[model samples]
Target chain A: MDFWTLANALATGLLTGLVYGLSALGLSVIFGVIRIVNFAHGEIMVMGMFFALIMFRWLGLDPLLSIPLAAAILFVFGYFLQSTVISRVAHLPDHMQFLLLAALAVMIVNACLLIFGPDPQAINISYSFDSFDIGENLIIDKSRAYAAIAAVAISGLLLGFFKYSRTGKAIRACADNYLGAQVVGLKVSHLYALTFGIGAAVLGAAGCVLLLLIEVHPYLAPGYTLLAFVIVIIGGLGSMTGALVGGILIGMSEALAAIIFQPSMKSAFSFGLLILVLLLRPQGLMGKSVK
Target chain B: MMGLNLLADLTLRGRICLLIFLAILISLPFWSSSYIISVTTITLYLAILGQSWNLMLGFAGLLSLGHALFVGVSAYMAAYLFSVLGLPPVIGIFPAVALAVLIGMLIGYLGFRFSIGGVYFALLTIAFAELVRIMVDHMGLIGGTEGLFLQVTEADRQGFDLINLRGHPWMFYYLAMLLAFLTLAGCRTLLKSKLGYYWQAIRDDQDAAQALGINVFRYKMYAVMYSSGIAGVAGVFYAFYQNSLFPESVFGIERSIEISLGPIVGGVGSLFGPVLGAFILTPLGEGLTEFTDYLQSSGLIDPKLKLNGLKLLIWGLVVALIVLFKPAGIWPWLNEKLGFSRKEGE
Candidate 1:
């Protein structure tokens, strides 16, 4: 590929990777705190996207401005789900827990399909079409740039919260050692609900930004769910920074792969990379071995 | 002889029920309409797939979310051999089974060798299935996304043609029934054997199994191979029964999820759980579709209204409730209520 073309692919890939990172970060945080892989993470993201669409269309609110509202709504929803349904199965065997999440995924996706219909919806603001030319050949969509900036900013805020906030430390304590956290009189279940709520809030923000970039549909969740899992695994399961790096890596690889091969084969590349990383480094690039 | 011995072990009531169930299955073609026959055929095949999945998930304590990979691979293999090579499906099935087993072994080796168990193993399987689906969609050799349609000759379509597996609905129905019975018998025998003990051991506690001198990896490989092999056979049946193979319909995550539901909703690890689950789920699913069609046709529902999403929503709710309430599944609970002797493996 030519220099400008390569640079353009890298830029697009990096930008898209920011969104992927943001999405994967939700899954990472959920796994980190709750110790349960939310199979419905992408569905939750799609739910956020739909929520944004609703607010944008019905209330005449700008999609970007609806981010906090959507995040708050999703946070409450996550807290409810964690406290009610997930906590019941938290003590079950691994397979049962997995099946519960899978069932939840089915319920959420199908529920969305029932309510929203199967049609793909997109919000077309003025910025959705606008792009800027950075140099002779490289061009970036304005909405995507804004989404990327939002993703980075959100990641920063999440990192800061986890590092400096009291609730964040409590969540970290619970994640680090569930039993020890309990011994220290930290209400483990409450902490879990809070962590899940934060994770969902992150996804809600990502969904608002994603609305500006792509179409939303019920079936959109599964692909994103799989991608998020791959990114989470690649970045290390519980590491926030790892999720960002892994997302960027996957995004760049997929973009470059599309240029090199058929566009359809890009998913294959991502899955292949996932399998390779899983086989070679189960602990992930940024994760430390627990054992 | 073994079957007879198994029959002898059951109570007289149990034996009678077994005989009656078999008789009903055998006579189904005589009294049932073609629609019922087709549904039953699908249920039987689903039972087979569920049983196969149960071997890994229920017996070996390994959950695979991408079993459609085996099904899709074998179905495509059988379809390809029959269409491109002009071979009979009966002959095509061998290579299909072999290919499925090969793939199963590859996955098992990669997974078990690296000690990848639990949810990670499930994710690996999902990734493999997706990768295969994408590759198959792009490969022109398999007709790409347009899919490959198997040709049925006039003679084959009209009567029982064992070679091409093209015949009336009853022929496929009987074939499916036989396959289901054989799979049940095979699973029952395996569950009674020493291998079953080793599998249960590994499933319950892999470290303890290793400490007790069981080769956890080899037995786990055995479970996967057997599971994939059975799934491959079901795929061959599916190929001929459907008379077409598409990458999306066969290899999609939905297909995997559908196959797993039978075992999950029915009861995992029980011999009859998959069969019972298939009977319950297939009829409910098909009945919902039929009901929706009836509503649309009878003008009760608007012509423009789409009911599939709603049907799926209800189905999801049912599955969720089942998972929440009866995590061990309905079979074990039913077994207790019916006063049947709950065998250890069963």
Candidate 2:
């Protein structure tokens, strides 16, 4: 392809990748702290998107403005979820745990189906079509830039919280050694709830941002879950930085694949990339070795 | 000697149960409505799929999230052969099964060779399945997005065409029943053999199995090959029975879940688990939809409101509850309740 087209695709890919990375980061945080892969991740994200959509429809709030509201709501849900149902299944085998979360995914998706019909929902701000030229060749959409900026800001905030906050350290301690934390009298279950809540908040904000770029529907939940998984595995499961980097790589490849091949083959391209990463380096670029 | 081989796992009581069950199935068409016959046929189809899947996932601990790939590939292969070259499905099924086995080997090689197990291995299978589905969506010769079709005349629907594989529901029903019996017998025989023992070894603990001199990689591949081959068989039958094939309908992850629900809910790694699970789930699931339809038609519920979601909500809840409470499934518990010994090698 021409240099201009290539650069444009690259820019767009990076922007979309930010949002994708943000979504995967939510999953990564969950896996990192709990060592439990949330199979219902995509459904939860759809929940966040719906949260945003509902607010936008009823309250005339911009999707961008509704990000924190969605995140807060999701955080509470995640907290209760971890404190209750997840605690019960935490002791099960990996496959059983996966199935349990997947079941939860099914329930959540169906709940959406019952609440809102199967039609895709979207937010149509006045600038949905607005774009700006950054350089001689590269043009970016207004929504894409805003979403990317918001993603970076939230990611930074999350990282800072993980690094600097006492609650973050306690959660990390539990992840480092749950037994050790319990030995030291840390409220491990409550801490786990906090971590899950934060992870969910990340996804919730991401859902709000995503609604700007695409439509939301219950059926779309699984595909997003798959996408987050693809991103997380590529970056290395349970690695936050890995999620970001993996997201960009997949985003770029998919964008370029759309230009190189048929648009429908974009997912195939990412999956091919995932297979390569899985076979060549199952641990991922930034993650530790798989035990 | 022939009789002994047939009685490999079954006790005398079990044999009596089998005969009685067979008699009931044989007499079903005489008394039951066409709807029940068709539903039973569907249950049988699910039993076959679930039994095949259990061989790999339950027996070898190979979690395949994309099993529909095998079914889809086999169905499309058989459908294409029949539609293009006018070959009968009975014959076309061989090549299709062979292809499915090859595909199975490809996935197994990728998974087992790399030592990818558990959910990671499952993810690998998903990638391959999704990849194939996308590629197939673009291909035009075999009817890409629009899907492939088989010809059916008004006469073909009412009367049986045993030769060309076009037939009435009775033909398909009998074929499904035969396949179900074959799968049950095949699994039973395999479980009694050395290969089945080795497979269960790998499934329960790979490292320990390897340390004990069992070739974990080889046996796991065997599980995948047999499972995928059987899935292909079901696929070929499904293609011809439906007289049309759609990519998403056969290859989608949802289809894979549908295939797996029987084995999982009925009980995994047990021979009769898939059968029992299929019998319970298929009828119940069909009934669920029918009940929703009833509500919509009777104006008890909003006609415009879609109830499939509510149905699925209950379905997922049931699956979750089963996984939580009856992890071993209902079959083994019932088997024990009736005083039959457990079926697994260990």
Candidate 3:
């Protein structure tokens, strides 16, 4: 009933939604360009979170500070994985490709479980408890606000890179028409690997940001994977801008639902929304209508 | 049995092999240990579920990741009816299957009508299952998160209550075997029918099938309905056998994955693949659990360490290797090893 409580939840949801948008942006970019959905996207993101956590424990580094390292590590892994394993299945049937990724997801999640055990892992940042007064009685958690700001900055950088950089433009060209790119002497396969690397890197950065909001556990991989898929599908599977918007919308809905009803209703609201989108607007909010 | 010549195409050697296998299964409880009986019961349950999934995936080219939606919904329906409404599962299973067919049609219609084939269709089905799961989790009428437990009495436990589908473990084992055989035969019959041919055409190439004058949409719907109907039966068996229903255990992605693995591992597109897959993977799963228990009991590992994830991890590796090296599955390879080879498309 209180105005500020509702306002604060909305604000927090907006912030968390931005981070989710960034995470989904990773999935969207790869699909848009390579036309291959990274079924193990969430597992890769979880690995990034564990990377951040490991750095925090060993070197007393903030998760935000470890973002670059995690991104770099996952980038290399993603690049190699696509070139080696995923490339083999890129031309296979859709279900086979999905199975391959799910298999990878299984391997990654269990590997993490074996290494870190099945317990929830989190970090203690000094600003976790700190909040900022936005005006009136409304307040936003400092870490959340910082995460949102970082998310926006990273997303902006990605957009700029895509819009202006040579490699980014080449990736876009490939997305538009890879055969054309290959005919023009572009190394399509290497570019595909690069695009996948960038996708993994973005997911890694988002994972680092997510560590500020929630704890990570090995079992959480599938849920996050499903959540990411929901976001991308809602945003229009291959649309980057739409993915961000969809994430925001999903986060806002879940936050409001949590405030209004039980927290368990969050998934219900999101999934229901997904079904509606799939039925009524398969192209998504910002995607062009497909013929 | 239906005059479709179900085994006319099968070789005499294959028929004999099947007869021997059937004999072993029919007499398993009398000679096998209690543990093996229970394991075989679980395996048979999984085989039917896997077969149902394979109908859509392998036969119709519909890759549904949430086939457990049928299993979960039907199981919940029967469980709720039997426990809350005092209806026996025999009748309860009817409504359960009806709902599953309706849901399957809705999913198929949405995906097929909207041109959402491939992975998008898969996601659509997942959304339905997850939505239902969350809804069931909040509804207290079905026990919500606390879960539904079907009560068992001394008589129900010690005696064979075929009417109620409750009794000694061996009774349930026999029930599972019977259901498995029934479903296997049903799937075989369907596969050899006109509907199965249409389904195969669609799976091989939809545009080509349409060009050839096949009613693609109608046949695809039939595939979904028939597949889900079988899955519903398996769900009823699950509700009675387990005597417990939790949304997560039944409706979650894990169950869906577990059900799909047998066909993928055994040999997708083959009639016996799901059974072979169930026979192979279920024992491995049981062995993994037994190994973990042994390790814990022998004090070879830390008590607090949860090694259960490794079992799934191994499955992941197996699937990945299979996808890479043995895309056809294990059954066909096994057939070759056994000095018998299937004719193309057989």
Candidate 4:
């Protein structure tokens, strides 16, 4: 309501949105290239968080330092997942593919539950609860700021990779037109594995950053999966910039809705936005219209 | 006459198989344990849900992931009426069905009008279901997060009471069986109708269907309404049988997924697919839970190591294997292997 309070909410929303953007980037990329909605993306992200938690708790490493390791591990896991299991159903009907992903999601979530138990775990770095006052009544949490910074840096690196690397260009080409890319001698299946791996790596890094700010649990994947879906739909499916913008918009609207109503209703706002965007503009803000 | 014709259409082998299956089910209470009867009741309800879902997903090609919305809302509606208004479930179910149909049409309109098909349509359904679930969780009027319980009197629980829908386990079992039978018959009838052809056409190719002058939107809406209505019937049965309603249990995404699995595993478009799926899946699911409980009680497995995830893990593996192997589902494959003529209008 007040100026500084509003500004603080805005800042918090933007920072949180960056994390959401990072989380959604992999989903967008996978969808863009493979034309498959990876329902297990969120579970993969949670796996990353668990990986980070393991590094921090058992090995006495900072979660921030564990990001790359977690990402690398997830990259391999995702690559194999696509190459082995997902590729089997790559040519199946749309609903079958959807069911496969849904099954994978259930498997991963429950598998994590079996391994980790149902407890919520968080990484406790030195600055976990520390915050700094920027100006007037506006303050920023140290972990949130650090997470946001990491998200932005990772996103920038991804953008650079997509722009400059040959593999990235091949991925883009495959996403643009799979048949054309195939005609041009792009190993589409191999590229698909690589793209999925990249997506998983991004989600892994985002998960590490997320663990710095919030608790992680086996059940956490569905909510984030839904959130990423909302963000991607709003931003335009398969567009990097769209995911970032959409994530921020969702985060801001959620924050604003929390200010207006109850915090429990934040998801209502996001879902509402998703339905609206779906009905009014299925193409989304920055994506091409779906045929 | 229609029923006679349908019966007449069956081959001698089909008729004999049907008679034997019916005899088995009718005599179940006499020989099988109460646990098996209850599991059968659950399977029957799941069959209804799966068949209902198949009407839309398999025939109409509208992939809906939020079917729990219909079941949950209808159950809550009927439960609320029974508890607060003191209305019997038989009467309460009518309005619940109406509400479910109305909601189904609204969603169908929104989805089909915008040409939202495939996964996008599924997401739309999920969003609506989640939105409703969250809202219901906060609404204390209908028990909110704590849930509502139906009152079952001693007399009602002891014997058959058709009015209040409170009776022995056999009573619910019979009711569920009748419902499942009627639903199967109804689906067969629908599939034989012109609307069924239109649905299949639209499912096969919406653009091509449109070119053929089929009213795609209207037929699709009909599918949604009919499917939701059937699911609403299942919900009413659920409320009366379970005698309790929880937003999390009823409206959860897991519930939606569970409802869809029967149809997916059985055979999506086939008439007997849902029934076969439910028969296979429900017992397996219940058996896993019972096994885990037994293991825990017997100290065969560590109590500290929670096996809560084991059932779902197995379910996931089963579903994955099915999707990978028999994507057309088990019924059609079984039908082929058995050399039975395919069910009419599939």
Candidate 5:
């Protein structure tokens, strides 16, 4: 295709990948901390988007402004969800968790359906369609640009927190050694809730960022779930760098594949890439190889 | 201790119960309402598919969310054979199952050899299923996205050949029953064999099993192939019964989820759980569909209520509830409550 067209696709792909990375980061954090797959993660993220969308309409708050509120709400939900429901089932046999989470996903989606219905809803910002032309070769949508900025900012913030903060260190400590962490006086139960809260909050931010590009629909959750999953695995599970790199790789590959092959096969292509990456490096790109 | 005797006598009592159950099933078509019969037919199909999935997820402990791949592949194989080569379905089904088994073995080889299990393994399987689905959707040879419908003609009427395949729901129903029965019996037989012990040992402790000199990979592959073969047979029955094949319907994620639901909800790694789960959940699913349809028809609920997502919601909720409340599943919980413990070759 033309340079402008290719650039446009690449930029969009990058944005999409970054968003995927952010969400995958959330998923990885939860998986690393809790050891449950959190199959409802995608649905929860979608719920965040819908929640943000509703807030934007009701109070006329901007999507960006609504992110923290959405995050706070979901944080509480996640905290309770883990402490009450997920944690109890987490230590059970594998299939129990799978079924439990899958079921919870269904409930959330249905609840969304019951409340929101199935029609696609978009937050109507006058500037939603606004964009910028860079040089003679590229045009970037304003909303996507904002989303990309937010993604970078969020990723940086999360990275900084994880590396420097005491709670973040405790979280890492727990992931590395649960008994050791507890022995060192890190309250394990509260830490688990906090980890889940952080994960949910991150996903909430990602959801708001995602809503900038695509309209909200309940069915969209599963698709996002699979996408985040692919990115996380490709990037290396529970690795922040992996999530970032995996997201971008997926976004670019999906965009390029859509251009080269059929658009419907976007997911298929991502999955194929995931399998290839997994076969080559099961531990993921930035993580130590697990044998 | 008393309950233990009841459980001890269950293997004998269970057979008689199954025989009576079979007799009732055979007579169901005769006495049951047409609506119930149709529902039963679909349920039987689900039961067969669910049982097939149990062979992998339940026995081998490989959690698959792409089982619809086997089901869809088998359906497409049957359809392609019948429409293109004019092969009799009876013969077509055998090869379809064979092909599906081979495909399963390939996937199992890749998965086990490369050491992908848990969510990663589940994702790989999902990817394979999605790839096949996308290919089928675009491939115009089998009617593409619009789907393929088989023409029904008489076995012998003037110049037309009639296969007697159409409008014969009972035949397919009986076939499904036979397959389900065989799967149940086959699973029981397999579980009591050396291979079954190997699978359990591997599931319980992979490193330990390997340490004990078990070829963990080979046994896992065999489990995958067997489960896939059984799923293919279900697919064959599914194609013949529906007389139509669409990539979306056959190879959908919903189908994959439904297959796993039975074994998980019933009780993974246990006999009788999947069968009971199918019996319970299949009807519930049909009832939900009907309720949605009723709401749509009566104009009492939003038209969107009849849409695809609600069923997903229900299925997901059921799974979650089962996990939350009955982690070991109804049968396993009951078995435990009655004081049944693992015995050595009892």
Candidate 6:
């Protein structure tokens, strides 16, 4: 590929990667602290997208404008959902937790199905189809470019919060060692809720950004969720930077694979890459134990 | 007192229980219509799926979210062999089953080798299954997204004559029963073996099991292999019974969830739990749809209730309710409530 082509693909990959990073961050936050796999996280992201779509229709708001509202609404929903339902399951044996989470995921999907129906919803920003030229040869869709910037900015802000803030420190402490942190008088339950809220908020942001470039549907979240999970696993669990790196790698690989191979082969490539990475380094590219 | 003692006699109890079970099984065809028979047959296939999943997830404590991959792969293989090559299903089943096992080994190796445990491991399996489904959907060699269909004859229709593969509900019913029983027996035997102990040990704590000189990864892989093999057998039966193989129907996440539901609800890690769970849940699930259709036809409920998304709400609620209330499973809870715990000695 020529320099322009390579750069364009890389840019596209990075934009898609940012979305993956956002979603993975949500899951990583939950996994990092609670050590529970919120299998329904993807469904929740879908729900968030649905909310954003509703906002766009009812209030004539842009999807990007609905980001804060989506995050706030989903964050609250996630917090209560976890505190009331998921927390109970978290205390069960690990296998039971899996079963419970699967059950929850099913319930969420079913609920989404009931509420949203199967028809896909796409948001077309006026500028979504418009592209901007960078330097001499690189061209990028304005909406996609905006999405990439938003994802990076959101992720960067979250990382900054985690590194500097008080609640962030508590989250880090609880995730690092739940019991030890509890021993030091940290409110583990609150920390869990906080983590869940953040995760939900991150997904909310991803949902908004995604809806700008593409559409949202009840079933669509699982695809992104699974892909994001692959990214999280390959990125190394609980590592934000790893999630970013893994997302970019997978996004580029998928883009390249789709260019060279058939569209259907892309999922296979992503999944194959996930298995390969898991086999070689389960700890991930930037391997580190969460605890 | 003497009458009570007589009623409680061991021989009398055995005879009564056995007679009741046999009566239920035997009279099913007589009392129920052909439609019910087909339902039962489908339930039996699901029961096999549930039992297989329970063995791996419940007993071994290794979660696999992509079990439908096994069913789909085996079904497609069998379809290709039986239809394209003009091979009898009896002959085709072996290679399909073998291939399924090989795929299981590949998945297990990729997963357990790297020690991907818990939910991440399950997600890996789900991803793999979706990948397979996507691949199959796009590949035209096996009919692509249009799916593969087997030719049908009058003999293929459901009836008494068993010479041909068609129209024999009884064959499928009996085969499913036999397969379920065999699986139960096989699992029981494994549970009694040293390997079973190792599995339980590893499930409880892999590190501890390793410390005790057990090869944790090998045993876990064995569990996955056996489970996948059982799913393969069911896949072959399903292909013949349905006479079609669609990527969505055979290999989708929905199917995987359906398979896992039995084990989860019936009580994982128990011999008959998955069977019981499947019989209960599958019928209920099928019944719900039928009931919805009946209601819609009768104009009792809103015609708008026929919408697709509503059922998802009900399904999610049921699963969440089960998880919220009886996480150990309905069967175990029933057993406990009925004081059916095994005696200390045996």
Q: State in Å the error of residue B211, model 1.
A: 1.7
lDDT against the true structure, each candidate: 0.89, 0.88, 0.89, 0.89, 0.81, 0.79
Proportion of the native interface contacts kept in model 5: 0.62
Using DockQ, give the best candidate's number: 4
- Residue A225 C-alpha lDDT in model 2: 92
lDDT (10s digit) by residue, model 5, range B1-346: 3223324435554646656877889999898887887778777777777777877877777888899999888888888888789887778988899988987997889988999877778878887888788888989998889998877555322232225344555666666777777777677778768998888888778999999999999999999888899899888778867879999888977679888888777777776678778887888878888887888889887775446667757766676777788877777776556533343124
Stretches of candidate 1 above 4 Å error? B5-9, B293-304
**For candidate 3, the TM-score of chain A alone relative to the native chain A:** 0.98
Per-model chain A TM: 0.98, 0.98, 0.98, 0.98, 0.97, 0.94
Best-to-worst order by lDDT is: 4, 1, 3, 2, 5, 6
> Pairing residues by index, what is the TM-score of model 6?
0.93
Give stretches of model 4 more than 4 Å off: B1-10, B293-304, B343-346
Candidate with better lDDT, 5 vs 6: 5
lDDT of 3 by residue, A90-206 (tens): 777777787788889999999999889888988998999999986768888888999999999999999999999999999999998878999998999999999999999998999
Q: TM-score of chain A for candidate 5?
A: 0.97
Least accurate 10 contiguous residues by lDDT in model 3 chain B: B2-11
What DockQ class does candidate 4 belong to? medium
- Estimate TM-scores for all models: 0.97, 0.96, 0.96, 0.97, 0.92, 0.93
Q: Which digits, one per residue and each the tens of the lDDT, describe model 4 over residues A57-160?
A: 89888777999899899999889989998999988877788788889999999999999989998777788889988765889999989989999999999989
List runs of model 2 lying over 4 Å from the truth.
B1-20, B340-346
Full candidate order by DockQ, most accurate first: 4, 2, 3, 1, 6, 5
**Clash count, predicted structure 1:** 0
> Which residue pairs show backbone clashes in model 1?
none
Give the TM-score comparing model 4 with the true structure, all chains together: 0.97
lDDT of 1 by residue, B1-346 (tens): 5566557546666678788988999998898898888899999999999999999989999899999999999999999998999998889999999999999999999999988878889999999999999999998999899998998777776798888898988889989998998898888888879999899999889999999999998999999999999999999999999988999999998899889888888888888889989999999988778887898999998978766576766677777788889888877777767744436364
lDDT of 6 by residue, B181-212 (tens): 67766777677678888888987888899998
Stretches of candidate 5 off by over 4 Å are B1-16, B153-164, B289-315, B335-346
